[model samples]
Target: MSLTPGLRFSRSAQYVLLSNVAVPYPARLPYANLRRRLNSSSRPRAQRPRGSPRTVLRRASTASETKPAHGPPAVSVPFDPKSPGSLSTPRDPIPPESTLNPPATTRPPPLDLPARGPDVSQFSYLFRLGKAYMQFYKAGVKAIFTNRRLLRSVAPPSGTASAGGALPTRAEVLLRARTRHDVSRLPVFGVLLLVCGEFTPLVVIAFPRLTPMTCRIPKQVEALRRSAAARREASFRRLAHLRAARGEKAAGAADGKLVAGHIARSLGLTSGWWDKAGLDSPFASSVADGAVAFLAQDDALIRSGGGVGGIEDAEVMLACEDRGMDVREKEVGELRKRLEKWVRETESSSEEDSKDKVKRLLLNHELLV
Candidate 1:
């Protein structure tokens, strides 16, 4: 048997640039579209009666009658075969050629085969209804895939209680929806097909490789992350004490009185500022030096800087660090000398957030753990 041509039809018949022949319109004749007759069929609409055809199954038409109307004409031609005028006369058929062919088909028809006729029973209403239902079910399955949000209403809930519990996160809801079927709980065949149609195929195809792959991936990722975090924590611990000490005395972090308070808090010194003889004295510098030693050991003392600690509760930690040296120049006179020096140093320091760095240093040193 000859192969069918791979040609396709199009309703829009724009001129093709590569070929000389213009193809038919996607519907039918291409020229018909140019004349604005797009819906025209082989038979015009008016020729048919108003009612549509009721037949569900169209009977196959018999093949065309190809026999000639009359027997072949006996032509009488008397002309030289070499002359141009010989084309005007008809050539007679060869007697041997005509006699070689059989009167009908070359092979006999199969008599044993059942005859084909109009089978009214096959086209009965019940069969048509069943066919329609099958078509609808197939269409419904396709619709489920396309409109996936419908699955959310039908997904099986996990909790034991009939009443709703806490709402699931967006991630949980979306993940559950992928395999959920609205029909899954229905009284249907085997109850498995009642599950999501798409979910069924996924379980069949990917279940072998998918389960093991999913299990291994998160474990590998978590272990890698935890090990890296542990390494970083260890590295930071090594630097915390050094960084805290350096930050306190690197030429101009805070006034001597302020440092004294930090030191007294870290060393648990008698909540220093007891009277006029308190933080103002020259001995405060020595107390401050001692404070920086343990400053990295406890975050409680340093956290008293900007966020917590009260002016009234001197027992907790001092809050005067926020005060500019100008206010304490009289009580802590040495601050005047350091004030100008501190400004110059602060101007020269890198523009990083000093407060945040100090906070991190305290936490790393187990000051705020």
Candidate 2:
């Protein structure tokens, strides 16, 4: 089927965004401006000596940039512009050859119905009539005696879920239930690529849940939302290990602002973490002169906890790192989980009570040295 139009990303494109953050989305960034941002952020702050941590970082980044490597390996963040996935230059478009297919034996099975008996003539006029009363079979002898028309209806009985209610098939009809599956497996980061190589029937598909035009838009919207939620949950499931890692380092502020930026960018964070974090603080500022990781205020009210009619403040943990991080899907899944837990405990508590909570975060949310 043709795409439903507007905001419907190509399956390959969506997979690329979800599966590989290293390859940024198709956002148009002016190369000159990005270079300036990168260069300016890369520069060292003043008042620090050449051997200071910040100054040392500048030298290392400069050295890496000056003599670029030809091919840095997976998860490499070499400063050089010549590598395949260099941070200095615009990322190359993911090649089409790399976007498609998996060998058989492992592909996700298509969403299909159990075979109907060959004798079940779906097209027979008599069969169509019977299918209409699939729900009434439960009404039993009383309803059978009450309505001759209902009794004669020969549709398959409703499944247990919708028994005694309106025909379950109404949803089946409203949903226009037919079968469709795509991607040999449940859709994930690399699934879209596989679709590019194969041709199919019964519409095996996931993500961006395509619908037959007959389905109502409201139903379509719900389906789309459910599909998106499933994908996001699946994304975190892969990172459950990151959440449980022990003894993470605190703010990493001790290392200097540049280090914070390095960690944030490597983890795919952007400027304005406070607002993104939805925390209240009196004196938070960016990690450095350029501002990738900002500092929280020494004494500020946390709106997250103080408001009435709000959800349990503990749940704020999810909101803290609500957005995705930039690092490879594998690196910081556990870290995200930890931050999520930390925000939750801190938000639910009194400021006086949360002092130890904050200290725990600084001590354990360890940054890469």
**C-alpha TM-score for every candidate:** 0.15, 0.19
Q: 1-369, model 2: which lDDT tens digit per residue?
A: 676655465776786566566545433354755776787789975675558798889888897556332211111121221222221211454221111111111111122123456687765644443332221111211121222221112112334333334232211211111111221122331243245322211122332333221111233334543443443343233223333453333333353432333333322233334324533122322422222211121111222222211222222222233222212223344544544454454553454445434433333323211
Give the runs in model 1 whose Cα sits over 4 Å from its true position: 1-122, 149-179, 183-369
Tens-digit lDDT string for candidate 1 (244-321): 776742323444344343333332233224322423345645654443332321222222222222111211211122
User: What's the CA error at residue 99 for candidate 1, in Å?
Assistant: 84
- Highest TM-score: give the candidate number: 2
Question: In candidate 1, what residue range of length 10 has the lowest lDDT sum?
Answer: 101-110
Model 1: residue 215 alpha-carbon error in angstroms: 35
Give me candidate 1's TM-score against the actual structure.
0.15
Taken over the whole model, the C-alpha lDDT of each candidate is 0.30, 0.30
RMSD of each: 38.9, 30.4
RMSD of 2: 30.4
